[model samples]
Target: KEVKKEIRNKVDAKDVNVLLDTKADVDEVNRALVDLNGQLNLKASMMDITATLQEQALLNTTLVAELCLGRWIWKSLRTKQGGLVPWNLQTANSDPSNLVWERDRTHIVCATPGLYELSIGFFSRRRPLVKVLVNSEPVLTVNTPPQGVTHHAGGRVSQSGRYTNSSVTGLTHHDFLALPAKAKVSLLYEGDDD
Candidate 1:
């Protein structure tokens, strides 16, 4: 029957030359081959970059680890009340116990600053409603979501550019800090297993 002939044709094409005899299938195979080649090139480039990073770290392991683990960076807000409340940029504070206040004036003092991406999160009870006030500028009232991630425990910015409200209207002073004289910062280990 026709089905038997078709099956035989498909099984017989054990090589590309046989597939090329069927022009349509040959074109499909060629397209797949092109995609695979492109993927291989990208993988090769990534491997090169990763190897470079590894070699550089090995050259300066102590300095690299100190930079990664010893710094505490934050964004600060100057308040009309004449003080500041520093917020950690790495962690998104959700008022874990209904303690995060909105409409409450909070001020922060910057320990160090270098073009920080500032943002505010608006939450009602437990859900994040919006994020506003990004890019060092403060807002009187937050009417939109913050520029970065929302409800993203990971602290990512949202794709849809939103800025939570902030009152960073008259704040100033941003600087960086180096550990104090003879300061020895070490990572505490509960056990060597860590």
Candidate 2:
């Protein structure tokens, strides 16, 4: 009974609202659905925020497991050496590439064999370059490309705290997904075990 109640409570509120508004005008109803869907997406995103904070705490402890890490979000292109490379990050609306988000420690799965570089950082307007060795090939490189502004931007690396631009540092092994048997992948943020 308790579990059923919990499941019902977890149902998306917008879905219920949409069902209630089923008799509304077609175009108006569609607009309302879109707005409600946006709100629902926001609610779902809040889970990621909470998960990130909780993950930061769990990482403080010595326990390691996969669920501790959130799901994989996105990946970038590989470098000339077959390493993955990173591009300047831009906020959803802003142009000229200002503001950065942190990369999840266990983010990115190598679906194929190649060198890959990951750039992890946070909300700095300035772009800083940091090179991380992927597969011990010095394959990945993080750089801020120069523009008409005449100079490079700030660095991407965060010096302190669990939250960097968007990524949570100090990850545990639990944060990573299980790789295939022949995966050339390595954990970007090695847990205490490393």
Candidate 3:
């Protein structure tokens, strides 16, 4: 009861009202939780709840449930080796964030220049090699069954579309790479040019 009063005092009335609602959106509740972060001493359980519900909300969509999330890769949407991967973005952060999917629906335009990480997870029978291209030129590429990679000086890779096998990512030891502001980035599979 004392803790509840403390929270009510620290947070604004609108946020407090949003908090008391039993049917508030999970994302909205998460926002309230974020507002409380560091404002007062709270139980570890509160932090645990915040972590567990991070960026997720309840869904009642039937088609998504039918697809089972990961099994719906559209083979037809997979473009040729040299072309931009025809991506079908499903969900994104509801809150305004630093990165955004470009209007073209083919690139993720980075708004700020900084080290960034992008993960591409997919299952394909053919080649698993993929490339991360910045503005039409490749940044990171490696050999098949890649041995190792040394990031070229000035942090640029050849534009010829050479890419490494996906497994090589684990061996690289780095989590993020230098990305330029307004960099239009996309992935491409090292598929047959024929």
- The clash numbers for all candidates, in the given order, read 20, 20, 1
TM-score of 2: 0.21
What's the TM-score of each model vs. the native? Answer: 0.20, 0.21, 0.41
- What count of clashes does model 2 give? 20
Q: What is the C-alpha lDDT profile of model 3 across 1-194, one tens digit per residue?
A: 99998976796988868877857788987999887885655556776788666634333333333222111122354574466675564355331244565333566666667666555543333334667788988887632443554433233223535532322222122235688888877766655331
lDDT of 2 by residue, 78-186 (tens): 2223323333232332211111223532223344332323334322244434344433433344444434333324333465456454323221111122333234332
* C-alpha positional error of residue 107 in candidate 2 after TM-score superposition, expressed in Å: 5.8
Considering TM-score, which of the candidate structures 1 and 2 is the better prediction for this target? 2
How well is each residue in 1-194 modelled by candidate 1, as lDDT tens digits?
99988877874536767766767677798999999999987675777889999988887865433343212223332222322233333343322221222222232222222222333332222232121222223323333333553442333333534534322121122222333222221111111110
RMSD to the hidden true structure, all candidates: 19.8, 24.8, 23.1
Worst 10 residues of 3 by lDDT: 65-74
Off by over 4 Å in 1: 1-24, 45-50, 59-194
lDDT of each: 0.35, 0.39, 0.53
lDDT of 3 at 118: 56
Candidate 1 vs candidate 3, TM-score winner: 3
Return the top candidate by TM-score: 3
